[model samples]
Target: MATGPAKDEKCCLVAVTLDKDTIGQGPPDVEHERRVAIYDLLEKNRFVLRDYADEGPYNLRLQIIDRKLVLAVDRQDGVPLITHILSLTPLRRIVRDYFLICESYYAAIRTAMPSQIEAIDVGRRGLHDEGSHLLIERLKGKIEVDFETARRLFTLISVLLWKGQGR
Candidate 1:
C-alpha cells in the first residue's frame, strides 16, 4: 500500500482487487499477474492503487491494510463487480456527493426487489460480511447490468477515488 500518515485517519481511501483466476483454482501465478496488471493500469491512469485483501472472489470482501482500506464485491465469474472508496480527512461534502453519484450508478443497475437492493446498499456501505452471499444470489437474475456499464462504472469510481471530484 502507499505509505502516508494520512492513511491513519478514519475511512481513508480503500481499494479492492479481484481477478479472473480467483473464480476457481486457475493458477496462483496467473492471479498474481492479473492483479499486477490491474495495479499497473490504475497507476498508469495516475491513481495510487493500494492492496487491501484476498477474499478469494467472495460475493463481498473488506480489508484494511497498510493504513489503506478496501470494500469490494465480486461477480459470479470472480471478476471485480464493484468497488467504492472513502478517505479519512478532507471530509469535504464533495466526497459525499461523489459517493452519492456513484451510488446512483450502482442503484441504476440494482434489482427491482427492495430487500435485495437494500442488501447491496449495505454491501457498499462496507458491510461486506453481512449479506454478501444473499446479495450475490439475489443479484444473479434480477440485475441486468451490461458489461459496458459495469466497466465504465468501475473506471469512473476508481478515478473518483484516486483523483477526487476534479472534472
Candidate 2:
C-alpha cells in the first residue's frame, strides 16, 4: 500500500492506502483522483480535515473544540459509514487509542467495497454545561466559524476529549 501525506495547511492527518495484495492496481490516478475528490468536497463544504501520513487502515478523527468527530467506514460494503461524535463532556485521555482501533476497522473494510462512496452521520449526543449547550445549539442547524473565538473553542473542546478517559 502507498501512503502519502496531504498538503492542506489545516489538516494534521491525511492518507490513502490500498490492499497490499492488490499490487499493480488499476491505475495510480484512481487513488489520486479519489483523494482529490474527497478533499475537494470537504474544502468546498468548509470542513477542515487534518492530514497524517502513516500505514493503512486507520481511523480519521477530527477534534473540533469539545467534540471528537470520528469517521468509520464498513469493512465490506463500505456503505453505512459511521461517524461517532464523542462529546468531550469532561474530556479523557484514552481517545487516541480507541480512535486507532476505529481507523483500523475502516481501513480493512475499505478494501472490500470499492464502490462505496457515501458518508452518513449516524447519530450525535453529548453532555454540556449551560454555556456549552448554548454554543452547541448554535452550531447545530448550520456550521459557522468565528476564527479567533472558534480557535479557542476548538482547543477547549479538543481538551475535553481526554477529560474522562481515566488518564
Candidate 3:
C-alpha cells in the first residue's frame, strides 16, 4: 500500500498575494474570477518546495517583473525561502487562447442554449487543464503543486498578464 504524507507533514500555501500593479482590476467578471482563485487556493492546496520540503505551510506572492513571473515564497512566520522565476513567453499563447475561450463561455452563459453553454464550458475547462499542465511543467523541479493548485495559480498568472480592459 502506498502512503501519503502524515497530517502534520502536509505541505501547502497558507497565504497568497498577487502584485496589484501587474494584476490591476478589470472587468467585474475577471476580477471576481481572480478573487475566487485566491479564495479556493487558500481554502485548499498542496505546495511543497523541491529542496525545502519540510518547511511549509508557506506564503506566496506572485509578481510579474520585467515580463517574467516571479514566485516569491516564505515560511509561515515570514522567513524568506526560494524565489523561483519563470519566463512568461511559453505561457503567452495558451493564456491568450484561454482568455478568448473564457470570454466565449461567459457570453454563452447568458444567451446561448444549454448545449451550447456546455460545449463552451468543455472547451474552457480543457484550456484551463492545459494551462495547469504547462504551469506544472514550468515550475518543475522548483516548486511542486498538484493539478488543482496549478489551476488556481494559472488563474492568478493570467490575471497578472491581463492588459487592462484591452482583452
Candidate 4:
C-alpha cells in the first residue's frame, strides 16, 4: 500500500477498529459516544498523508500497546499503509479533564438551568478543542487532519482512554 497521497487529493477515514482486549468493554454511554464519533468522522473528514500517493477512504485501527496509542492506516482492500504510535502521556491530563467536564455537563443537563447547562457545555467544548489541538500537534509530520477530523478523532481517543482505564 502506498504511504503518501497524490497532489491535492482528499482522503477520509472509512473504518475504525478498537482493540477490546486492551480497551476492555466500555459502559453504554461510552460505547454510544464511540459510535457517534466514528459515524461523524466517516460522514465528514479531511485526512492527508505527507509525501505519499493521495488515495482516499482509508481504514484506521486504534489500539493501545504499552500505554501508547497506535493508529494503523490501511487501504480500502485491507492493505497496510502506515502506523503512527503516539505517546499517551501527553493525552492523559486532557482526557481526564474532558471526561470530568463531560460528566458535569451531563449532570447539569439533567437538573441544572439552561444557563448552567450551556456553561458546562462551553467548558466541555473548550476541553475538546484543547484535546483536538493536542492530537493535531502530536500527529504533525505523520498525518494531517482538519480541525473537525481531529475533533472526532480526539473523541475516539478519549473513549479509548476511558475504556483503557476500565471506567
Pick the lDDT winner.
3
lDDT: worst 10-residue window of model 3: 1-10
Q: How many angstroms is residue 163 displaced in model 1 relative to the true structure, after the best TM-score fit?
A: 19
Segments in model 3 whose C-alpha atoms lie over 4 Å from true places: 1-10
Q: Each model's TM-score, in the order given?
A: 0.21, 0.20, 0.91, 0.88
Q: RMSD in angstroms, all models? A: 18.4, 16.5, 5.2, 4.2
Write one digit per residue (lDDT tens) for candidate 3, span 70-167: 99998877899889889988998899999899899889988999999999999999999999999999899999999999999999898888863266
When 1 and 2 are scored with lDDT, the better candidate is 1
| CA-lDDT, candidates in order | 0.35, 0.33, 0.85, 0.80
| Residue-wise C-alpha lDDT for candidate 4, range 1-167, written one tens digit per residue | 11223223347666677777766777777778888887777777777766544655577888888899999887756788888898999989999999889888877878999999999999999999999999999988988899999999998888878866657
Where in model 2 is the C-alpha error above 4 Å? 1-38, 46-87, 90-101, 104-138, 141-167
Error of model 2, residue 95, in angstroms = 6.4
Query: What's the CA error at residue 53 for candidate 1, in Å?
Result: 29
How do the residues 1-167 of candidate 1 rate in per-residue lDDT, one tens digit apiece?
22122222222222334332222332343344335534543332211112322322123333432323244655323567456443323223333444454455355555457776665555454422222232233234423223332232233233323323222
Error of 2 at 58 (Å): 30
**Candidate 2 lDDT over residue span 1-167, tens digit each:** 12334334332223323222221232333334334533433332222212211221232333333343333322221223344454543333333443333334455446644333122111111221233444444455333333332333333332333333322
Q: For candidate 3, give the lDDT of residue 61.
A: 89
Q: For model 1, what is the alpha-carbon lDDT of residue 92?
A: 33
Choose 1 or 3, whichever is better by lDDT.
3
